[model samples]
Target: MAEPILKVENLKKYFPVRRGLLGALRGEPQRFVRAVDGVSFEVYKQQVFALVGESGCGKTTTGKLVMKLLEPTDGKIYLEGQDVTELRTKEEIKAYRRRVQMIFQDPFSSMNPRFRIYDILEEPLLIHGIGETRAEREELIYKALEMVKITPPEDYVNRFPHMLSGGQRQRVAIARALILNPTFIVADEPVSMLDVSIRAEILELMKELKEKMGVTYLYITHDLSTARYFADWIAVMYLGRIVEMGPAKEVIDNPLHPYTRALLAAVPEPIPERKDVIKEIPIKGEVPSAVNVPPGCRFHPRCVYFKEGLCDKKEPQLVEYSHNHWVECHLAGKI
Candidate 1:
């Protein structure tokens, strides 16, 4: 098998929940929120591998971990077979940053309100010392902006973030991520903040960029429909664990995990052909706290097919049910 462009193995991030001084003095054991318990996945070159789940399910945390924005409590992140998580030297880390970039969820807040668009896009190149002269830097910035379809870069270059619309600001954000010529990008809900009308355009622009540059994407999102549309492969995460994963169409057309089925049920059906297969809400209850995740199958409490004694007592391991399709549930193949 060809090596993945980016890979994560047993990724874990646990944020300690600090106690009061009195509790500390009492010698209480520290508690930690298991934001990303044990996530494992890979992204092939030029592929959009999406991590989809509801809010607080650790989708965003996983993205941050892959980007090295948050140091992992334990795990390995490899970029082209090199373990970046162990990088120590300043130069090594700098090189890693240049190869990997992020497009944040909010277009409005991700950019600096004070900096001009030119400065924002040029910051990466300047920091990396890529352009020798001012003219060189300006040319690089113009090309990046033009790639994202923000035409006449000169007109927009001097304008501030507040001057651009939500869609245009997001285009700037994409241009910023692309300026460094990154090989991989962790796009955390990049289009969620845009208006419905503009979301398709932004997604299409990203697709074009991927094809043009051969850049791989770790697309983090909560919307299954968007995930299905944007991703080549899909991994459904819950309570920091991947419950199911496979090719995008197979996972969307024939989900096996109850949680995955429930998620698909929640997506509004816009076409008549899918009406017959849309399962009714398969579970009830809000997502459980990550700090105190339920024992056994983390999803049993909310799963419609929860079994007595079994599902609540032992967690299921991820298993392949068909060609390249994997699912984690006791009911796999049986359901």
Candidate 2:
């Protein structure tokens, strides 16, 4: 296997929940929302690794941790085998920042309404010191527009955010990220807000860009259907922990973890025979508060196969089931 372009080990992020005046006076223990608790994964060079889970499951939070948008409470982040988490110097961080970029989920909010598309794409080039002059930046911006397939580049370059459609706005976002020629990108649900018809086109464009540009991606989304089409590897996240991960085809075809199976079951299938196989894995009650997570397995409360003593008392470690296939479940081998 190729050496990973990005590696995350025991990554964790916890946001402190402040108490009100009355509660503060009572001296309530400070609580933290465990947004990403001990999550670990790797993205190989030029690979699309999809992080999938329902909302509030910490997929977005994990992405932010990778980009250093939100600093991790614990654990180390390595980029190209360098320990980036320990880079404290201003110059060190500034140099690291240029190699990593993010494409946010909401295109409308991510792009500035005031800035025209040209300025939006040019900003990154200027910030990164990629272009010395206005003419040089404009040339790069036009190339970026063309790369994302925004035709005639010049026409779309002058327009504001409102002049473009949802998909077009997202293309601009992709262009902005690519303007610097970043090695790795964290795409946080990049196509979720777009029209269904245009979703495929955008995904295709991204895949094409990967082939042409050799960019690695941490593709975050709740859409398993898109994961099936795009990701080379899949990691199933549940309540801030990755429950299962493996080759995209193997994991999707033969999901080891119950949570992984449940997620795949939820994906709509066109085949009539396969439709009958989609058994609804009923997760009783809502996701428990992250502030006070359940003991042992975080998923035991909703897992059907959860055994009382073992699952509730002993937290299962992520163990490899086969080459490149891993699962975090007490019943992994037994199942």
Candidate 3:
């Protein structure tokens, strides 16, 4: 196998809890929200590796950490085998930004309503000092738009973000990221904001672009269905840690962790035979607050199969239960 284009080892990001003045004066112990507590994963060239979980599970924070948008409290991030944390100077970070790009969740919010599509797409090129002349940049912008199937770029480029459909705006956002010819892209819920009918179109376009451009991806999403359809590898995150990870097909079909099983059960089934069947979600309760993650197994409070003494007293290490399938749970293989 080829070497990984991106690698993250024990990635962690903790946001310190801000208590009021009285609480602080009282000498209350400081607390932290473990947004991403010890995530580790890798992505090979042109491979789509997905970080999947429900909202507030740290998947998005992991993507932000990889993009260098946020600093890690403790961990290492390597892009193409280079230590990303070592990039300190503005020039060094600028150079790094050119090689890595991000596609945000909300197209409407991520884009400037004031800027025209051409200017929006041109911003990255300007920042990276790409395409010296306006004509040259125009050509590149049109090419990127064409690549994303936005068509005849001249027509759309002249318009503002509000003038386009939700799908079109997202396509423009994708073009903005691709304009840099980045080595890796962090797509954070790229299709979650689009209409259900158009979600597949956008994903298909992204997959096609990945092969065409030879770019790898760190796809962050909560929808297992999309993850199953679009990603080669899937890592199921829970409260800030990966509970189950493996080949997308294997992890979804033969989930080892109770949390992973519960997630799979929640995915809407389309098969006619199972359409009317009432499926019981295995786990209980909403996701716990990150500030006060449960001890031992962070999921024990919500896990249906949690064993009292063993599950509450000891943390489970992520271990391989099968070939290339890693799970973090006391009863991984047994469950």
lDDT of each: 0.92, 0.89, 0.93
Give the Cα-based TM-score of candidate 1 against the true structure.
Answer: 0.96
Candidate 2 Cα deviation (angstroms), residue 47: 0.6
- Estimate, for each residue in 1-335, the C-alpha lDDT of model 2 and write its tens digit: 77889999999999999899999999988999998999889898889999999999899998887887778899999999999888878778777778998999999899889999988988777767888899988899889999998989999988999999999899989999988888999999999999999999999999999999999999999998899899999999988899999989988888889888788777776877566665566456678888989999998998888899999999988889889999999898676
lDDT of 3 by residue, 178-264 (tens): 999999999999999999999999999999999899999999999999999999999999999999999999998999999989988
**Which pairs of residues have clashing backbones in candidate 3?**
none
- Residue 82 accuracy (lDDT) in model 2: 92
Better of 1 and 2 by TM-score: 1
TM-score of 2: 0.95
Candidate rank order under TM-score: 3, 1, 2
Query: Which candidate comes out best when scored by TM-score?
Result: 3
Predictions ranked by lDDT, top down?
3, 1, 2
Comparing 1 with 2 on lDDT, the higher-scoring candidate is: 1
